[model samples]
Every structure is written in C-alpha cells, then in structure tokens.
Target: MSEKVVLHYFNGRGKMESIRWLLAAAGVEFKEEFLTKREHYVKLLDDGALMFQQVPLVEIDGMQLVQSRAIMNYIAGKYNLYGKDLKERALIDMYTEGIIDLLDIIMLWTIETPENKQKQLSNIEQKAKERFLPVFEKGLANSDFLVGNQLSRADVHLLEATLTLQEIFPTILSTFPKIQAFQERMKALPRISKFLQPGSARKPPTDEVYVKTVKEVFSHIFK
Candidate 1:
C-alpha cells in the first residue's frame, strides 16, 4: 500500500512551503488539510491535536508530527535529502537554522501595526545586509547548493526563505550575486519549476486577505 500523508496548515504557504516542496520534489502524494477558518484552527488547538499549538502539522505513516523544521527533517531523512554522512548533515543543519533565522525576520512583517511594520522592514534590511544574506552568499561562494555539492534540505529551505523575502522586498538580493544566482538555479530544477508554475499551490499570500488573515492568526504572538 502507498504511504498515507496528510499535511495540516493554514491556507497560505507561510512556514509549510519548504515541507510541501520536499514532498513535491520527492514525488510523494499527500493530502493537504488547510484550515481556512479561524474557529477550525482554534478547535484543533483545543482538541489537543496540535501539541505545540502551531500549524504545518503532518500526519504520516501512522505518526503525527508538529513543528515545520522537525517535519521537514523527517521527510528529508526519508527522501535522502538530509546529507550523505554526519559532517555533511551537521553543515546542512547549520544552513537550515540560518535560513529559519531569516524566516523569523520575514514573518515579523506580517504584523499589521504601522510601527511594527516599519520596524520589521528596517530589521529585514539590516539583518539581510549584515547577517543572513552575507552568510548565504559566502556559503554559496564555493557551490550552488548551501550544504554539500548536492541539493540538500538546506537548499530547499534557503529557496523558500529567499522567495519569501523577495515577495516583500523585491530588490533585496540585487547586491548578493551568488545568492541571486543560487535562487535562479534552484527554481530551474524540474520538480521545483513545476511546483512554481502559474496557479500552483506553492504561491505565497499576495492579496489583502492574506495580510488580514496573518494578522488575525498571529495576533497573540505579535502582541
């Protein structure tokens, strides 16, 4: 029998894109349970379905998993996308953590307050310049992929982070030639390219409802 996998998350991509990308790249057939209603999400939390009270939960092979990174790591291990050995896996983890750091800053922009919005924009610019972007640029200085010479989970996470940031700040990667080139290279992959085609589910939030919904869902955390 085929493996049964169900991914639960909000309707938008947000934290779940990398996991979705991994499944797609691995040619895994899975079901998506998008929580489109606020009450539905709260219901899951109240029912103890979410251990950490977060979305992007995955139910696979008789196991339910929480946390985006954990789910991605599990899937990557199954698909051999983690790395070849211990040292390579360590480097991949390092790069993945760095990408998550960037993702945290990008997520801060979802808050709808004027002051917080401005602060997040400034923070993204600063972090991109002094921290995240430089790290990735240098990391990619020797190879197109972030960890090892092959396409590891780190590269997938980095692509997601780069695309997320690019959506908000279109010209953010102009100064970082290597990172920009890496983004292009990753997008050209057969699986990823198809996943990114027009009308694909991989598209991130771009409409007014996206901002409103994000603010509503994250109100507790942002406040």
Candidate 2:
C-alpha cells in the first residue's frame, strides 16, 4: 500500500527526513504534500502557514507547525520518545543534536560541486568513522538505547543517522560493532521494521534528478 505522509516539504531528505523517521518509529500514519513547484511553496507563504518560511512544515492536530527541529521535538515528545524525566530529555537533546550534525552534511552533499563532492564524501567518512559513530558506539556500549536504557528520541535520531550513513557509505559501520547491533535491534522494532520495508513513505537518496528538481523548485533559497 502507498504511504500517505502529512507534511510540507520537497520530496527529498532535507530536514523532513527526521520527522518522517520519528513518525514512522511511532507507527503514526500521516500524509505529506510535496512542494515540487514554486506555486506549492508560494501557497504556504500565501496562507501564512510557514512561521519561518521554510519547511518541513507539518500539519497535525489542526496546527501548522514549521521548523524542522521544533517539529521533531514536538513529535518525539508526543510519541513518548522524548524521555521519562527532564535530565533524560536533556541528554536526548544533546545526543540528537550531534546526530543532526552528521545528517546535515549528508543532506548538503547533493548541492556540492563536482570538485567538492569527493572531498565532502571523504570528510563525511572520516567524521562518521572518527567522531560521530564512535560517540554513539560508546553510548550504546552499556545500553541498547543512547539514553535512559530505553528507546528515546536520541536513539531514533541516531538510528536514522546510521541508516543515512550506510546508504552513502555502506561499510561505514564495519568497526562499530555496537552500532551494527544497534541497527539490527532498532530495525527489529515492529514500527521501524515496517518503515524499513519497500513501498514505505521513506524518501530516496538525493540524486541528479532530485537535485535538479530542487534547484528549480527552490532557486531562490538554493542560490
């Protein structure tokens, strides 16, 4: 069955991907309105729905929520993925922020010039192998989750980041045994397992065609 997403963003990873991950992890059903044309973006602007004039603007519970980080936090909190207490939530926030740093590089990779693409990819591999993955690997050293010994927003975001890295660098986690095990465990969750299956709402990796479409659709922003 085709997945119906509930959000406003281009049909690519960008910032919306994290939101998709959270909703999928929660087993929540939603619909997404892809803004492929300038008119689509303009519609949001015209409707005054975008608080900051950027996506991923999400429509849920009769409220138009903009800003990707805010949307993610809201979803995480709503789904009981945030944490059990304030300290746990803070740790989740801290860990997820690091994961976001890794995702930002991947999301920006599509725009890098041919000259810089290889360099960027190399940098990503280095950071993932050296910095990011090690952090998560060690975080999961004592527990399956990154925080509070249970699934939380940090775990969800970390799982999403690992998947994205594997999509680009398939063998990136070869040395990170803990993360490898973590991936298997996270994917086994009924909700996340469903999301990992084919024909899910998950977006594909950014490609030439997607980049071209994005440049045309968001010329003002990209330029």
lDDT (10s digit) by residue, model 1, range 1-223: 2267987776666788778888877768787877776776788788787998888788887777898888988999999898999999999999888888887766656644677787678778788778888888999998878877788988888888888888878888999999989989988898888878886668565455766775676577646
Candidate 1 whole-model C-alpha lDDT, 0 to 1: 0.80
lDDT by residue for model 2 over 92-140, one digit each (tens)? Answer: 9999999999899888886788888888888889988888888888889
Model 2 misplaced regions, further than 4 Å:
1-5
Clashes of each: 0, 7
Error of 2 at 149 (Å): 2.7
Q: Which pairs of residues have clashing backbones in candidate 2?
A: 4-30, 4-31, 5-30, 5-31, 5-32, 6-31, 6-32
Q: What lDDT does the true structure give each of the candidates?
A: 0.80, 0.86
In Å, residue 186's CA in model 2 sits off its true spot by: 0.6
| Weakest lDDT window of 10 consecutive positions for candidate 2 | 1-10
Highest lDDT model number: 2
Once superposed on the true structure, which residue ranges of model 1 sit more than 4 Å away at CA? 1-3, 42-48, 206-208, 211-223
